[model samples]
Target: ARLLKQYQTHLKKQASYIVEGNAESKRALRQHNREQIKQHPEWFPAPLKASDRRWQALAENNHFLSSDHLHNITEVAIHRLEQQLGKPYVWGGTRPDKGFDCSGLVFYAYNKILEAKLPRTANEMYHYRRATIVANNDLRRGDLLFFHIHSR
Candidate 1:
């Protein structure tokens, strides 16, 4: 349980870093655009609303799982992982019969319950497009975590 908690925390941190970097980049880009517009008002007729429209569309398309549903999914995954506590770690294994690797373990546990299939490897999971980065304090059961091991 402790190990699982640690993994959850690690995943939250990785996601937060990615999210923070994206927000910072967006802010920088907006500032740069503002400066360019100020210098050449004639070149820019009106402010861009494309980004806003994209965000609105994304929000409209997103489906949020209810708290109860989320909790049930988390419990199920954790239970599955706990059942394999003594299993050997295999390099690319994804099932109990063959043992399980890090990402494979996560894939097995949450993939079925989740709307989208997770990437088979940690690196890909870290960069998954649909991933949402929650605040550290908001980390809860069923959160998938990614960590850099020896720069891998």
Candidate 2:
């Protein structure tokens, strides 16, 4: 019973992360919505109409985005990740007892904190997330950012 409850809790968390990520991605894409459709047919679903109200409704629903909802989730994730940081490194370690590579560390961190399963490579993680192009001044606590480190 306890295990099942934990599994369900994790499932709900992952679901929430996916929804939030999709919401963020959708909002970010709206800036280039028109040009994007013209340039890349393979990147998205069939072109959406400007008159689409469903998207707007979803945005409204997620808008207020109270800090309580976001903050607690992040804290939980971080705590879980911190607990495993000192684990031994392994080639593809994703658990605390084994060691982690750079991407594995990132993947584990996000999975632990965000309940979001990110790709196991930095490049892949960059590509998997929405391209929101956040400026340095606009960064928030949980916002993911990438920096080019001496040509990788």
Q: Judged by lDDT against the true structure, how good is candidate 2?
A: 0.56
lDDT of 1: 0.62
Measured with C-alpha atoms, the lDDT of residue 103 in candidate 2 is: 68
Off by over 4 Å in 2: 1-64, 112-116, 129-131
What lDDT score is found at residue 128 in candidate 1?
A: 76
Candidate 1, residues 1-109, lDDT tens digits: the string is: 5545654554455344321246667666445545543453322234435586544332332222124434555776788788889889999999999899988899888
True-vs-predicted CA distance for residue 11, candidate 1, Å: 28
Q: What is the C-alpha lDDT of each candidate?
A: 0.62, 0.56
How far off is model 2, as Cα RMSD? 9.3
